[model samples]
Target: MLTSVYRLVRPRQFELVFNDITLDKSHVIVHPVRLSICNADQRYYQGLRAENILRKKLPMALIHEAVGRVAFDPTGQFEEGTLVVMIPNTPTEKDDIIAENYLRSSQFRASGFDGFMQEYVSMEPDRLVALPEDVNLSVAAFTEIVSVSYHTIQRFLRFSHSRRDVIGVWGDGNLGYITSLLLKAILPETKVCVFGVNEYKLHDFSFADDVYLISDIPEDFHMDHAFECVGGAASSKAINQIIDYINPEGTISIMGVSEDFAPINTRMILEKGLRLFGSSRSGREDFLGLIKLYNQNPDLINQLEKIVGAEIHVRSIQDITRAFEIDIHKIMGKTIMIWEN
Candidate 1:
């Protein structure tokens, strides 16, 4: 079968390429229905990555967050027209102690391998999760993003020694909002405080126990554990604040993606005996857990609806470009691309 793939041929340039797909019985063919533009995609689209890295990674398909329908399934595992969320992390090898997401042999779509920006993507059956018939395709499109928060918090639960009370989240972006919301959903008894620079963005975090501007954080405010969702240039500042406000021996989970190395207060980390870790991408288990969460808490879908900033019906290549252009400027919420072409 020939698949039409949209690739980033060069910085800010995309080209359509055709590739033949030899479908295996172990794989299911998916036709992307809706896609969400991630910040990482924008970094590549805008050429924000280092020149050398860009040169090495160009001509690759550009999206990892997407929901699609099974068009062809040789094994009959999923019915045709079934809505599904596509998992991008492909792990070829596994270890007893290491999770698949952290496996050295894992191949993540849109990072090094071809992504789902194609008319049809042939994927291993395990790489796809069936969505509920009534599931919101727009919200399901970014399940990958929500699953990251699930993965991070699940890891934090294993590593933290604190009471899980008074949790703090740094950043006002979609990540912080989702992380805080997940914390609330998973541990409703715990108090979640959010700190960020943008008050307008913070307003959306009404579910949080409290939302405070980073500049006006109470002097005596402290957290038992913290999550740093702020990335890029402002990451250093957010990390410093998390270290400063977090209690001794607290756990800190870093989820942001930064282009350059960001320094943290090592002295404080050591002095306070804080445990810090980073989480990226996610695995099938996380995706399943997120679905279970949604099943348990049906209101989660309503809460997630608040994060949909813009919806673009992509009918042409120009629409794809326009979605990226609009996404780069969004301060809050996600810009979703409904695959119409």
Candidate 2:
């Protein structure tokens, strides 16, 4: 039997994936689920439109971040009621459409598959994560973004020795704050400095050792390593700035996606002998480590709550456009969709 799955679609554009499939035999057939829409982005939609028209291809699916309950799992690793985060990455679940024929194939369940914006969703048993007893399922929605930071840090830390080293972060958005949180937790002795646009965006970042409003590097401050959490032209500028001021041999880990092309100062990079790296999804080991770290230091999680901007109900999925506006206004730190009982 086929189940109905709702998707956010644009006219001749990409649809969000929310897979609904039948099990051979299962105790529960339908599970009501919730999906967090990462603020509706008109620019993103426009970009998709332009790409489609340019390439003469139809539009694609939208959602890349989400968390949901188990719908069906015959093997019993995931029960119908367990709360979990979906790892949209391919390697963790090889059966994913993207992984089957390499990422070039867009057949994955969430990224390319049907997403979780509907009343019911069908996901593989292994895709479900049993949330810890103490973790609130609602807030757990940020897990995917946190995992992005986790994976980015894992790559940067591979080169560093002690947490006492100082790290620089460019951009003060959700990813930047979370990246700092992960770094501070792992390297308690490390001092972090975050640079961003407005004072309001950087307020929660009072925890940072230093906060810079100006984009240029200060004379006194020198970074052992740097992270570019803002994508686009700003990220490219930050990359060049880091290359100019970063301590010789330091590494740069880029976490955010970019829209416009930015020139990289290859001359400075080669002169400084810097180590630049890029990471996509967090490995299973990275997620497990983050979970362990979160469990040990719940305070970090508490701090993260400060940046959490809004908790609107899932029933308001249609209001995602308004949600996006709220986020852009900086009225909400991290916007989450509440899945009600």
Best by TM-score: 1
Worst 10 residues of 1 by lDDT: 8-17
Candidate 1 off by > 4 Å: none
The C-alpha lDDT values of all candidates are 0.93, 0.63
Model 1: per-residue lDDT, tens digit, 1-341? 99899999887788888999998888899999999999999999999999999989888999999999999999888999999999999999988999899998999999998988899999999999999899999999999999999999999999999588799999899999999999999999999999999989988998999999998988989889999999999999999989999999999999988988898899999999999999998999999999999999998999999999899998778888999999988878999999975
Error of 2 at 319 (Å): 3.5
lDDT tens readout by residue for model 2, 160-183:
534337888888887788888787
Report lDDT (Cα) of residue 242, candidate 2.
72
